[model samples]
Target chain A: MKRKIEFATIVEAVKKCCIEGTKVLPQDVYLKLEEAEKNETNSLAKDFLRQCILNADIARNEAMPICQDTGFAVYFIEIGQDVEIIGGTLTEAINEGTRQGYKEGYLRKSIVTDPLFERKNTRDNTPAVIHYDLIAGDKLKITFAPKGGGSENMSGVKMLKPSDGRAGVVDFVVNTVVNASGNPCPPTIVGVGIGGTFEKCAFLAKKALLRKVGEKNPNPLYAELEEEILNKINQSQVGPQGLGGDTTALAVHIEYYPCHIASMPLAVNLNCHAARHYEVEL
Target chain B: METKIIKLTTPLTADKVQSLKAGDRVAISGVIYTGRDAAHKRLVTALDENRELPCNLQDAIIYFVGPCPAKPNTPIGSAGPTTSGRMDAYSPRLIRDCQLRGMIGKGNRSQAVVDAMTQYGCVYFAATGGAGALIAKSIKKAEIIAYEDLGAEAIYRLEVEDFPAVVAIDSSGKSLYK
Candidate 1:
């Protein structure tokens, strides 16, 4: 017999996800902030890093958003085949929960109705970007990430020759961040996607950002590669706000998938220290 | 750190500017109006129309922000600096036409804005971008000054005390980023 999960439970879970996601700022990000503070060489940059930590603390205490950008809400939902949701549709519940969380949490309403003309505010932050996938269990898992535009603006993807290999990937990512400079709010988390098709590579790169900082790839070779990329990125000396210093990037995470024999695609997504994401399983 | 409150109507002198550096903490008292992209566009359009501005811009520091709606019993919600670059195009016009002296926001400014700062002896200050609630504590009061139709984007006359900020760009053409 299939187990039925109440729609209220799903809505409550999503609301909790949004609240926890905005307030906590993630353990990986916290570790990265501490690391960036230690590694920052420029005095101004060091102070800025310290302020970022303090900002996190204040946000936690106040139960408010850590950044003014509150960000565009995006969710990745893994739904089980055996579980049935009652009362309302999943999309309706999620959007309703988003509106409630943004209104109740005092987060900013960043969405506008029309991007081109009549740029009227939607009033409430709504219509989240939801990606759903089906899995084989009775459990429902969801991850909500509030992606700010600064780092989102700096993300890039490319389809290179298989012969170009790892060197090509490194050069592309480093060049992207170096060019970005202080725009994305430095000491960023670099997410690299390799091997998948063009769109898949981009998707994987964003998903890779959700991984914990300092956590190594399961594959030893990939783990070593991540370390190398992290070191090389710091050497750029872009520092915080592009003032030129020792620490430019906090961590480099790479996630890969098998690609076609002839195709080699790479994508890179840069996330600022405000990288806010949280997950819940119901 | 010692705190002092300066009213907005008082003209900012060179001595006042010199007293503050890239990292000095300050609390602005009295009336200071807020304006961002949409309101700025309308203000500039009014100037182009050869009409007077909604509020006097002489010696004023325009804050580039669109704060969240005020919750009940609260003056304002999570008010913080938005990215300053988005307002770069509209800022030079405001500075030149309206005699605006200072700006408060985050990130870097264009060379043209820097040039205007030097020519007009203006300054650009950086408020803590993400520390909205902590920053809000310094603001004792807030009222809608103009552009009420813009919703949260409306112009607000805020009265603040000990609002912490760093001078990102000074009158000497020196940038904090450099």
Candidate 2:
């Protein structure tokens, strides 16, 4: 017989996850912000960074959102094949939890029904972007990330020739950040996806952003490349708010997957200073 | 990093607006109202209908924000500035009709809006967009004066003290970025 997980328990967990995720800025992001504050050279940018840090502290203390753009709630779930959800559907529980959390937590309902025309606020902030995978174990793992639109707008993916190699990846990432100066709120966290298909590369780029700050890649070559890219990005002098200074980026995280011989796919996902995310296992 | 509070009425003169510039840290005191994309649409609609506005716009600085909902015992929730470009289409009308003199937000604005600010003696200020908690500290009180049904997007009459901001566009048509 399959192990049963109560729907109400899952709903409660989802609500808690969403609320806590918005209120608390992730540890990695906090470390990055602290480093950015220490390294910022421009007076105005320094003040801005200081305010960002204060904002995080206050948000956590008061249980308020760190930013007005509470963002679109997204979750990646890994479910066990041996476990079964009882009482309700998985999607329904998650949506219900999202609605409750947005209302109770006082977060902004940022979702609109239509993209182009007749754009209407959904009010409850329901219908989260959820990704699920079947896993071997009986445990259910969920990661929540509140992705702001500014950085999301700046994300890009490219397919380069195998001959392009590391140099091509560096150029593309730097160019993307330079072009996006001040738009995504600099002193950004860069997530690079390498060695995947077009869609897979984009997915990996976002996944890489979930990694802890200052953490090195497991692969020795990739780890070295991450440091190289970090040095080049900090040299951009875009600084905080593009005012020109040292420390344009806090860290560069690279996630790679095995790909076909003919193609070299890459992607870059930028996360703003207020990177809010959390994970829970049930 | 000292803070200073300045309070001024709307339909402000060129001299007052020109005195401020980008990167000059300021704390805006006194009465300011909030509005964003949805409220902008309604304000424009009211103007088109020849109906009365929810609040007096003359000599008022309209903040482009749709703050998070207020929790119990709290004056306001995470109240931060929204992107200003989203309100470009409706701002010119507000400036002309309501004698509005100042706007506050972040990021770029359109040429027409810039021209309107110059012609109308209005100025644009930028508050740090993501610094909601810190910004909320400067807001002493917040009351919903209009459009209560719009939820967070409603017009709020805020009594603030030393609300920090930087002058993005000056009265004489000088842009900080340029």
Candidate 3:
């Protein structure tokens, strides 16, 4: 027998996740900021890191958003083969939830109806970006990560010859971030996606940001790569808010996929220190 | 070395901000205006077409921000600075034309913007990036005065008190970024 999941349940879950995610900075990110502050040598950068912590606390306590740029809603969802969604379409349910969450939570409605020409506000944040996956169990899981424009604008994708190898990847990632400086709101959490096609590489880079701040990649080689890239980035003196210090980045996460032998593709996505994500499983 | 937190009040004049230098922290008070990407485009367009702007921008500080809606009983919500680079194309013109005294936002600016600041006796300040909720406490009032249709990108008159920022570029063309 297939498991029946109510559409309202998913809507409510997404609604709560959107509000909570925007309001509260995740524990892992908060702790990492604390650690960064302790390790920072520059007094100004250290004070800025402390302010980030205080800012998060104020948001959490007051039941308000941590930043004005509440971000574009992006969802990663998984559905079991034996599960059925009833009463409405999954996409509609999520969009409805987003509309309610952003309105009720006092989050900014950032989406403009059209990107280029007549950039009109949607008023209600709707038509969220969603990715779906099929899994074996009788369960449904949804993860919401709000992506702010500042950090997203600084993200990039690059195609490299296989001959360029690890050296090329490191150089590209470091330069892209260091060059951005304070524009993306350092110290940032960097997400690097390697291999795959152009679109898949972009997706992987964003998905990599969902992982815990300190969690290393399961693969030994990628784990080592994460540390190396992170060290090189921190040495650039970007620091907190790019004013200069020892804590330019909290973590560097790399997710990889097998691709055609002919090309190497790389994507780099950056999340501001406010790094907010929340999820639910049912 | 010790750093000083310079105090400032709005409706700023060139003489008032002349002493500001790169690396100095500032606590700004009184009135300032808020305008971001779209609002800037409109403001600059008005200047280009030789039309009058809705608000008086002379000797003003324009903060680059779009705040979250206020919760009941509060004057404003998480009001933080956005990336300043996006406003580059419009800033030099505003600086020279309006006699803009100071600008508050995050990120390094262009060479043209720096050059304008040097010539026009203006300063650029960078707020604590991503510190939105905390910054809101400094904003005492906010009322949309122009381009209300732009929603968050609307131009608003804000009354701020001790609004904190750091001097990113000074009148002498000194910059904190490499």
Candidate 4:
């Protein structure tokens, strides 16, 4: 029997998630910040990390957004095979929730109606980017991640010859962070996607960011690479806010997929220290 | 490295700007105007038409910010600096044509902007980029002064007290960007 779910139920849950997502820092992120603060050596960088931790607390307690640029509302949803929607399309429900959440939460509407020429504000920050997948259970899971342009704009993709190998991927990732410097708000979390087609690689890179901070990749080799990349980034001395210190990145998360034998595609996505996100199970 | 701690009032004089150096910590008090991309274009267009600016620019500090709306009782919501590179094209003109003396934002400025700062006796300050909630505490008042249609991007006159920032570029053309 198909379990019927009302569209309104999804909207309310999504709305709550959107509001809470921007207002509160996830536990994993908070823990990472605290750990980074304790391990940070430079006095100034340590102080900046402390400020960020305190800022997160104030935002959470006040029910205010962690950052002014409330960001593009991106959702990852998993729908159970046994569930059937009753009232409206899933996309519309998510968008309605985004509109109310951004407006009610008093978050900034950063979306422009057009990319070029006559760029105009969308007002309520609608048309959320929603990605969906089907699963076996009878429940629904939704994760809301508000991605700020400061870090989003810094993301990059590079296509290399298959022969370039692991060294090539490392160089590309490090160079992207180096070029970004303090612009993306340093002590960033790096998400890397290797293999796949051009667009798939980019998607994988962003999806990698949804992983819990400091959580190792399931593959031992990938987990080792994550640690190596993290070490290399911290050694760059970009520090907190790129002022030159020991902690340039908190963690490096990588996801890979097999690609055509001829091409090796790599993508890098960065999330700032705030890294606000929340999840809901319905 | 010894960093200077400065307490500066608004409508800063040339001497005040010259006294600042790269890496100094400043707590600024007094009135400042907020303008991002849209408001900046409008200001420059007005100048091209030989029209008066909405706010006086003499020794003025323009904060490159677009803040969220205020909640009940609060003067402003989470407010932080946007990337300074976005305003580079208009900043040199604002400095030369409007006597703008200071700017507050994050990241590096264009070479033209750095040169303009030295030529016009101005300084650039960088606020903590993502600490919007903490920064809002210093802002006591916020009112839209022009381009209200721009919504969050409208020009705002803000009354700030001890607003914290770091001097990223001094009047001598030296910058912290490199």
Candidate 5:
């Protein structure tokens, strides 16, 4: 018999995740900021980093958002093949949770109803961007990532010839951070996606950001590449808020996918130090 | 090597603008108007049509911000600066046409914006980007001034005390964007 789960349970879980994601900066991210604070040379940048830590502490204790830009709600859902959701569609449940969470928690409603024409506010911040995958499990897992516009707007993708090679990828990643500078709220966490189709490449880059800050990839080659990119980005001297210092980026997380031999696609997604993400299981 | 600390009050004048230099840390107080992307479009449109703006632009400083709604008994929720580049297209016009003397936000401005700052005598200050909750401590008052239909993007006049920021660009075209 298939394991049955109530739709209301998913809604409540998602609602809590939304509020928690906005209010709490993950412990790993907090520790990385502490490490960045210790290594920073410029007095001004160090002071700025300290303020970021204090801000997070206040948000956590007060149950408030770390930044005013509460961001667009993005969800990654994993459902078990043996699980059945009763009473409502998964998308509807997730949207309802987002509406209640954002409204009741006092989060900013940053989403617009239309992109090109109407450009009207969605008011309740509904219609969250949802990604779903099926897995062999009996429970439903949901991850909420509130992506802020300042950083999301700075993200970009490039199509490179296979000949561009590793050097090309490094240069592209470094240049993206340099070009973005303080716009994405450095010291930023950079997520790079290599290979795959155009859209998949972008998606991979965003998914990479959900990884814990400072957590290395399981693949040794990719883990080494992550460290190398992080070093090069910090060398850019963009520093904290692009004010010029040694700690331009906290970490660089990369996710790779197989692609055609003829084409190489790369995408860079940046997240501010807030880097808020929370997960729940139902 | 040292960051100079300065205090600035709104309704800024040219002399005050001239005194500010790149790399200085400023604590701004008094009343400053808030407007982001959409409100900027409307304000610039008003300028193009030669219509009166709801707030006086003479020697005024505008903060590029859209704050979260205030909670009970609180003046405002987490309030911080938005990216300055989004306002680049409209900033130069506001400076040249309306005497906009100061801007508060993060990131680098466009060349046209830098040139306008140089020609019109203006300065750019960057607040700590992710420190919204801390920044809110300095904001004592906030009330929507216009465009209420825009929700979070509405224009508001904020009364801040010792609101911290850094001078990213000075009146002399000096910039710390690198």
Candidate 6:
């Protein structure tokens, strides 16, 4: 049976998610900050972590964006095979929801009409970077993340020779994140994507960011890789804002897929301390 | 926090600029101007054409930020520092031509800019990145004075009180990053 879903329902939910996503830091990420503060020994670096905690509190209690760079509104939609749309197309509804939410929620519009030439503000933070997946079920899942430009600018995708192996992947990921230093806003969540093709690996890296901070990969081998990366990053002493401390990164999450026989593709996407992502299933 | 926090105000004086050291926590009060990549681009363009800046740059502090629009009854929203590296291409010229005294933003600066700061007696301060909402509380008033069409990237004049920051680079070319 096809489950009928109203276009308005999705619009309203997207609007709410846009506001809720940027206004409130997820509990898992918030708790991780608290833990980082407790574990960090450098007084100055610990203070930066404290400010992060306090900033989230102010943003939530005052109904303000956690950061001024409300960022590019990104949406990940999963549509079940057994679902039917009642009013309009899914893309149109999502964009409308984004427009209304950014306007009503007082979120900043960061999107440009053109990337190279005019670079005029779109006025509404619309035409979101939407990704869709078709799945089997009668439900729809909407996931939203407000990705800051500073962090997003630091993303990397590299094609490596298969023989480069585990050691090579680890080195590239660490180098990219560490070289980024304070620019990505440290105590960041490192998202690693291994395998897949060029663009596919980058997408995988971004998708990996939606995972809860400190959540382990389902595969135990990959989980061990995550732990190893996390320890190495923290030891870099890049600290909060790359100013120096023991809390450079709170967690590292790795997502992988089988790829071409000869090529090993790797992508790293770093999410700042204000890692905000929210999802709803209907 | 056992560290002694310094309290400073602007338009800053030469003596005051020289007193700061890397890693010193500062609470800045008084007037400052905001700009980001676009505004910096324009300002440098104006200088190239031998035109006056929208505001006098002498002894002025330029904060690299693109703030969220203010809410009802609020001066500004979620105003935080952006990475300063993008401004590297234009900063040395501003320092040499206008005696630009200080800058507030996140991330390390380029060598040429640091050399200019050392040559011209300026300082670089860093705000906690991503702490926008907390930082907005310090901005008492904000008004767009130039390039309104640029929206967030437009230059804004702000009245601030006890704005929190740390010295990332000092007048002598000393830095926190190294």
Candidate 2 residue A215 C-alpha distance from true site, Å: 1.8
lDDT of 5 at B113: 98
TM-score of each: 0.89, 0.90, 0.98, 0.97, 0.98, 0.99
DockQ-based class of model 6? high
lDDT of 6 by residue, A118-194 (tens): 99999899889999999999999999988999898888988999999989988998888888989999989999999
True contacts kept of 3: 0.83
The candidate with the higher DockQ, 1 or 4, is 4
Of the two candidates 1 and 6, the one with more favorable lDDT, higher being better, is 6
- DockQ scores of all models, one per candidate: 0.45, 0.51, 0.87, 0.69, 0.87, 0.86
Better of 4 and 6 by lDDT: 6
Q: List the residue pairs that clash in candidate 4.
A: none
Better of 1 and 2 by DockQ: 2
Q: Candidate 5 falls in which docking quality class?
A: high
B23 in model 6: Cα distance from truth in Å?
0.6
Clashing residue pairs, backbone N/CA/C < 3 A, model 5:
none
The lDDT, on a scale of 0 to 1, for candidate 5 is 0.92
**Per-model TM-score (chain A alone):** 0.95, 0.96, 0.99, 0.98, 0.98, 0.98
Per-residue lDDT over B101-165 for candidate 1, one digit per residue giving the tens place of the 0 to 100 score: 77888778899988887776677887755556667766668888788777767888777766666
Residue-level lDDT of model 3, residues B88-142, one tens digit each, is 9999999999898889999999999999999988999999889999999999999
**Interface RMSD (Å) of model 6?**
0.7
How accurate is chain B of model 6, given as a TM-score from 0 to 1?
0.98
Tell me the tens digit of each residue's lDDT in model 5 across A84-179: 889998899999999989998899999998999989999988879999999997889999999999999999999989999999999999999989
Compose the digit string of candidate 4's lDDT tens values, residues B1-178. Answer: 6545689998788899999998788999999999998899999999999999899998999998889878889998898888788899999999998789999987788899999999989999988878888888899999998988887899999999999888888999887665
